[model samples]
Target: MEKLLISACLAGEKVRYNGQALPISEPLEEQLSSYFELVRCCPEVASGMPIPRASAEIIDGPASLVLEQKAKVKDNQGHDVTDAFVRGANMALQLCLSNNIRFALLAEGSPSCGSFLVYDGTFSGVKMQGRGVTAELLTQHGITVFNVNTIQEFIDQLPLVICNQSFINADFMK
Candidate 1:
C-alpha cells in the first residue's frame, strides 16, 4: 500500500520550533491514520534549530529560500539558517525515495513544510502562495504534496495513490 508523509508538528509531535502542533483535521487524522502509515517530518527543527526560535520570514527570493540579511528569526542572534533548512529538505526527500512514498501532507505556511503558502521570508506578515523548501524539492522529484489545512482536498487525493509498479504504470497510461 502507498504511504503518506506528514509533518511531525501536524501530528502533534513536539518537533516544531514553537514546540506546538498546529491544527489537525480530525477526519483526515482518522482516515489517514488507519489506511496509511505516515513518515513524519519537521524540516526546520530537523536542521538543528531550537524550538521557540525566531519566527522567520522568507526574503531575497522564494525559489532559493534566501532570507533578508537583516531579518533575524528571534532573540539570541538568529542567523540565516537557509542552508540547514535545505539540508532538512534533502533529508525528507531521502525518506520519500527510500519508502517510495510520493505524496506528502505538509504543514502550510512553514518554511520547512508548507505545501501551499509560506511566509514571504521577510518576517513581513504577508502570506504568499508558494511551496516551502521541502515541498519544492519533493514536487521537483514528482512527489505530490499537500497540507492538512485543506483536509477534504487531500482526503480525496489519498484514495488515488498507487504504490506498486504495475499500478503506477496503469495510472501513468491514463
Candidate 2:
C-alpha cells in the first residue's frame, strides 16, 4: 500500500489564503478516498495562522525567508505571517520523512504549497519560477511532489510491475 502527501485544501478544505478550496478532480478524489492513505497538510495553517488570513511573499527566496524574517505571508491587514509559513513547511517535511509518504500533490501558485509558479507577492498575479514553502522542504527530503496535472505523468513513469522491473545502462540515456 502507498500513501500520498496531499495539500489539505485540495481535499476541499477552506485553507487557502482567502479561505477558498481549489478544484480537485473527481477521479483523484475518489482514488484517495478508496485506496491510498493521505497525509494531508496545509503548510500555511500548520506553520501558524488563522483561516481567511492575509497573504505573504517569499521576498528573496524561501530559504532566505526561513533564515531572515522576510519571506512572509501577510494579509491586507498588515500582519506578519512568517512563522506560519515556516512552521507549516517544517511539519509537512516531518510528516513526509518520518512517515511512508513518497509522493505529494501540492497546490500551485501559493505562498505555502505552490509547485512551480509562485506569485511575486504583489497580488498582481505576476508569477515567477519558484517553489512554495512546503514544496521546497518536501522536495529536499526526497518526496516527489507535483501538481494535479503532473500526477498522471509521474504515475505513467512507474512500471506496471514495480517488483520485477529491470533496468540497464541504456535506460538512462532515454
Candidate 3:
C-alpha cells in the first residue's frame, strides 16, 4: 500500500495545542483507510512541545521566509520557538523522505502543518494564504501537501501523481 503522512491530531490523537483531537469525519477516515497506509505525526510534539502548549504563529512573513531565517515562529508568551519549528519541519521532511511518502494530509491553521491557510502571525485568529513550515518544506521537495478540508482535491489529483508504475497498480482509490 502507498503511504500517506498525516497530522496525528486528524487521526484522533490529542496532540493539538489545547490537548484536543480535531474532529475527523467518518467518511474522511474511511477514505483515508481505503486509499493509503497512514503515517501520523504532530510537528509541534515531534519538536518537543508539550500538549496544551502555548500557541504559536509565524512572524514577519510566511513559512518560506521563516525557513529562510528571515522570519520567526513565536508562541503566545512571545517566546521565540522558531528553532523548534524548523527542527520539527526538518524531522517531518526526513520522515517523508525515508518512507518515500509523496502525499501529506496536514492540519489546517497550524504554524507547523498548515497547508493552505495559516494564522497571520498576530495570534488574533486571523488567517492568511500561506503554507506552514513543514508544508512548505515538503512541497519544496516534491511532496504534495493537503489540508483536511481539501481531501477530495487530493483524491482527484492522485491518479495524475501516481502515474509511475510503482503506484499505478495499487488499489489506492478503493
Candidate 4:
C-alpha cells in the first residue's frame, strides 16, 4: 500500500493545541483506511509542544519567511515558538524522506500543517492565504500536500496523487 502523511488531529487523535481531535467523518476514515497506509503526525506535538499548549500562528509574514528565519511563530500569549515550528517542519520532512511518503493531507489552519490558509498573525481570528511550515517543507521536498475539506475531495485527489509518480520521482531526478 502507498503511504500517506496525515495530520494526527485529522486522524482522530487528540493532538491539537487545544487537546481536541478534528472530527473525521466515517466515510473519510473509511476511505483513508482502504486507500492508503496513514502515517499521522502532529508537528507541534512532535516538536515537543505539550497537548493543550497555547495556540500559535505565523508572525510578521508567511510561513516561507518563517522558514527563512525572517519571521516567527508566536503563541497567543506572544511568546516565540518559532524554533519548535521549524524543528517540527524539519522532522516532518525527515519522516517523509525516511518513509518514502509522497503525499500529505494536513490540517488547513495550523502553523505547522496548514497547506492553503493559516490564521493571520494578529491573534484576532483572522485568516489569510498562506502555507504552513511543515506543509511548505513537505512540498519543497516533493510531497504533494493537500488541505482537504471533505471526504469526497480526499477521494477525488488520491488517485491523482497515487498515479502521478512524476511528482514523487522528481526529487531523484534533481
For each candidate, the alpha-carbon lDDT, in order, equals: 0.70, 0.72, 0.87, 0.84
How would you encode candidate 4's per-residue C-alpha lDDT over 75-108 as one tens digit per residue?
A: 9999999999999999989998998997788999
Most TM-score-accurate candidate = 3
lDDT of 3 by residue, 56-106 (tens): 999999899999999999999999999999999999999999998988999
In the predicted model 3, the residue pairs found to clash are none
Candidate 4, residue 165: the lDDT equals 35
lDDT score of model 3? 0.87
- Identify the candidate with maximal lDDT: 3
Candidate 3 worst ten-residue window by lDDT = 165-174
The candidates, ranked best first by lDDT, are: 3, 4, 2, 1
Q: TM-scores of the models, in the given order?
A: 0.80, 0.81, 0.90, 0.88
Model 4 residue 5 CA deviation (Å) reads: 0.5
For 79-127, candidate 2 gives per-residue lDDT tens digits of: 6666777788889888887876777899888777877878876667698
Off by over 4 Å in 4: 157-174
- Overlapping backbone residue pairs in candidate 2 total 8
